[model samples]
Target chain A: MDFRKKLAIEPGSTVSLADINPEQDGGIESKEEGKEKLSGILDEITPLQEMLYAEKKHALLIVLQGIDAAGKDGVCWHVIRAMNPQGTYVASFKQPTEVEKAHDFLWRVHQRVPAMGQVAVFNRSHYEDVLVARVHNLVSKQVWSKRYHEINNFEEFLTENGVTIVKFFLYISKDEQLERFEKRLEDKDRQWKISASDYAERDRWDEYIEAYEAMLSHCSTAHAPWYVIPANRKWFRNLAAADIIHRAMLDMQIESPRPTVDIDEIYRRYHHAVREA
Target chain B: MDFRKKLAIEPGSTVSLADINPEQDGGIESKEEGKEKLSGILDEITPLQEMLYAEKKHALLIVLQGIDAAGKDGVCWHVIRAMNPQGTYVASFKQPTEVEKAHDFLWRVHQRVPAMGQVAVFNRSHYEDVLVARVHNLVSKQVWSKRYHEINNFEEFLTENGVTIVKFFLYISKDEQLERFEKRLEDKDRQWKISASDYAERDRWDEYIEAYEAMLSHCSTAHAPWYVIPANRKWFRNLAAADIIHRAMLDMQIESPRPTVDIDEIYRRYHHAVREA
Candidate 1:
C-alpha cells in the first residue's frame, strides 16, 4: 500500500488518536537507512517542483496542524527547502492582529492561498479556528461546530479552481513532548523558544487531542486529504513528509508548455544562431 | 445635500436609464469652474487617503462599470492618480481564463480585494457576470438571474468586514458613443483602440441599458451603494468621480493611528540631545 494511502485519514471516516501511533516509522529501524531513503526522494522532488513551476497551470497548498513544538518548522526546513524560492512560499499564521480579528477567520487564510503554479505552505492554517478556538472557547460552541462544513466547502471551492491540497497532522507523544521541552530548557540558546505558556497549553492535553480528532475526521475531504505522520522520531517524520509530497507532485501531470511557433522553424532560427556561435 | 447621497443609488429603489440625463453635470457648467471645484476635492482626498493608509483599519473598494469608452480608464487615470501609489492598486477584469471560468464569478474578484488600509479599484468587477453575461446570453437566464442576489451577498460580506464599496455606472448617450467612435477613427494614435467588436456591442445599446437598470435596482444595498454618473463630458466625469470619492473617504472617519510609544519621553530625550549639541 502507498505510504500516503496508509497515513491518509479517509474523508468522513471517524478518527481517534489511539488509532494512530506517534512512534511508528513505516517499519523502518535504522536511522542511517531512513536518511539514505530521504536523500533519494529529495533529489526527485527538485525536478518535479521545477516542472510544476514551469507549467504554471496548477497550485499546491500544504497545511500543517499540530500542537506546539510538534515539528512543523522541521518539516518546512527539511522537506520543502529543496524547491526554488520563487516557486514556493511559506505563510505562517501567528496570533491574529486586531485587523485580522475584524474580518472572518477565513479572510486571512483566503488571502494567503497560492496563485497559479505556486506551492503555499501554511505552518498553522485555518484549522486553528476549529481546534484551538474550540478548545479555548475563543468562539461560541455553535460557531466552532459549524466550521467543519464551512471548511469542507472552502477546500472544495479551491480544488474546483486549479489548487491541490494536502494536510498533515504531525503526531507526537506527550512524554516525548516533555522530553523535548526539558532538552530546550538545558540548552541556553533554545531556552527562549520554550516559554511557560507552552507547558500551560500542555496541561489540557486531552482537550486538544479531542479537537484534533474531530478536525481530522471532518476536514479530511476527497479533494484535500489529511495524513497523520508519526513524529516521535525526527528522521521518520522528515522521510514521511518528503515521500508524500513527492508523490503528490508526480500526480500533478505537470508538463512544460508547448511552443506556440513551429519547432522546426524555431530550430532553423536557432541553427543560424548556433552556426554563428 | 451630501454629494454622495446626491449621486448614490437609493437602496431598494427601481431604476430606469430614461430617468437619467447622460449629459447632466450636477447642474454645473463652465469647464474652468468645474476644474477648480475638482482641484479642491483633490486636495482633500490626498490627506484623507494617507490617514486611511496609516490607520490600517479600513479598506475601500471602488467599482466602475460601463460600456467601452465610457471613461473607465479615464476615471482611473484622473481621480485615482492623486492617492499615494503605495496604498492604492487597480485590477482590471478582462475575459475569464479557463481556471477562472471553473469557479464562481466572484472568485477572481475575491482574490483581488484590498488588504487592510489600502484602496482597490476594479476597472470592471463581478458585475460583468450580471451585465455582459446577461446581454450576450453567455449563460441561461436562470444562471444570470441568480447572480444579482449572489453579488449582493458578496458585497455585503465585504462590507461586514470593514470594506466600503462604491459603484459607478458611467452613463453615455448612444449619439455620444457614435461621436467618440468617429473621433477614434480620425486620430492615428487612437486608431488601434477602435475595434469592430465595439460597434457590434454598441448596436445592442438598449439591451445593455436594460441590464444596467436591473443591476442598479437589484444589487444596490445600503452598505454598497451604486451611483450613476453622467459621463458624456470628460471634465464633469472627473469632477463627479472625485467628489464622490472624497465624500466617501470623509465618511470613513479615517484618522492617523495614535503613537504607541511614550511621546513625552521621546520629546524629553530630543531636548537633552539639543542641549548637548
Candidate 2:
C-alpha cells in the first residue's frame, strides 16, 4: 500500500475527529518535519506578515473543501495558528440565510474577504454550491454546473486585484467516513455533534465525491491551485496544511508595510506632542 | 481634573502597545487577570454562543464609533483579540465601494453580521450614515435624519431575534484628538496614517459631535444602549470595555454546551477510539 493507504488505516477504517492526531500515531514522520519547517518558514515570512499589515495592500482568501469528516476545521485551526492574530481572519460559511439566498452565490463570500493586511480562511467555502447542491439536487444540475466557471472568474478577479487564494480539498475514503460517523454516534460528548442530516449527507457520499473531483479538475488554477490533501491521517493532514500555508505566505513575499517614520522619528513626535500638551 | 482630563493634556499621550501595563494603569491587575476575566465572560456565555452556533440564530452587530484617533482600532484589536477566534469577526468600514454606494445605508453593515455563536464588530459602524455622511453632506439632512429611526428598528429586529447589539462611542476631547493627530503627523512612521482627508474631517469636529449626540439620544435604548467610553486613556478604555463585555457575556450566560453523555462516557469514547485505532 502507498503512504496514503497506510495512513488511512491509522483511523481504524473509521474516520473520527478524535482519531486524527499526529504526535501519538507516529505514522506520519513528514508531519514532524513539517512542524520544524514551519518555524523556519515563519521567520522568513515574519517580515512579510509585517509588510502586509503596514501596507494594507492585499486581502488573502483560503478556501477549504472536503468530504464529510474530511477535517476542514482541524486543518484550518492548526495551519494558520502561527500567524499574527491581528493579521489573520477566519470566516466559516454556513447554510445560507434568507437574505443570502436572495443574492448571487458569491455575495456572502465577498463581504467577508479579508482586508489587504488580513488573511481569511473559508471553512467549507463556495464549493458547497457544487458539492452539496449538486448531490442533493438542491439546485438544478444546470444551475449548479454554471457555478464552477463563475467561481473561477471570481477567484481570478480577486487574484488580479491583489487577493491571494489558496484552496485545499481534504480527501477521505467512504469506509473511513462510516467509521467516523459510527464513532460520533457512540461518543456521548461527540454525539451532540452528529445530526440526522449528516447521515443523510453521508448516504450520498459517492455523489459528493464525484462533484468534488469535478470541482478540482475545473477550479484548480495557477493563481490558486487546489491542493488535494490525503486527510485519512490527521497528523499528516495538519502538518501538510501548515507546510502549504507557510510556503504560500513565503511565496507571496508577505511583509509588513513600512510606516513613514522610524523609531527615532516616532520618539520625536511623542516628545513634541507631549510638550505641546 | 479627572485622570481622563489629565491624560488628555498630553498630546500623543499613549504608551507603547508592548509596554502597556494594565495593573499599573489601574485597569485590570495583570494580563492574566484580563485573560481570566475574558475567559470567564466567554465561559458564562458559551452556552448561548453554542446555541447561537447550533441554531445559527441571530447575527450580532457591534458598532464602535469615536472621534479621530480615539482608539476605535485599539478597542477593536483588544476586545476581539480575546474572543474565541473562530466565533469572533471584525469589519472595518472604509470608503464605500462603488457597489456598496449603489445600495442602501445598511447594505455593507448588514452583510458583515456574525452568524450564530459568533461576534461581529463594526469598527466605524452604520452610524456613519448619520455622523460622517451627515457632516460631509455625503447624504442630505433629510436622508441622514431618517437613519436614526431606521437604525433603531434595524437593531430592534436583531435583538428581537436573539442578536445582542452593543454600541460604543469612544469619547475623546478635541484637545486629545488634536494631540493624537499632531503626533501622527510628526512621527515619520505614523505620518502615512494621517491623510489630508483626516484633517478635513477634523475641521468638522463640532458637526460630528452634534451628529453623535443626536445619534446617542435616539439610539441608546435598553436593549442596545450605547456606552460613551472615556477613551483619552487607552488603559482605562481597554479595562472599562473589558468590564462591559464581561458583564454583557454574563448577561448572555455564555458557556460551553454540555455533551449528551457523561464525562466518563466521553473518556470511554476517547479510549475506545484509540483502542480501535
Q: Could you tell me the lDDT of residue B189 within candidate 1?
A: 41
Candidate 2 residue spans exceeding 4 A from truth = A1-50, A53-57, A76-118, A129-158, A172-190, A203-219, A230-239, A254-277, B1-48, B82-87, B96-118, B134-150, B172-191, B199-214, B232-236, B253-277
Predicted complexes: DockQ each: 0.01, 0.17
Q: For candidate 1, write residues B61-120 as lDDT tens digits.
A: 999998888989778767886675546666779899999999989999999898788888
Cα lDDT tens digits for candidate 2, B1-277? 1232222112223222222222233444766665565565445443444444544445556678887798887776555555445666677787899999999989888878766667778888888788879888997788888898898888887788777887777777777787787776565455567655665687787787778777877777767877666667676676666666555654664433554444344335433543343
The global C-alpha lDDT for each of the candidates, from Candidate 1 onward, is 0.82, 0.66
Q: Is the docking of candidate 1 incorrect, acceptable, medium or high quality?
A: incorrect
For candidate 1, report its TM-score: 0.51
CA displacement after TM-score superposition, residue B76 of candidate 1 (Å): 0.6
Q: What global local distance difference test value does model 1 have?
A: 0.82
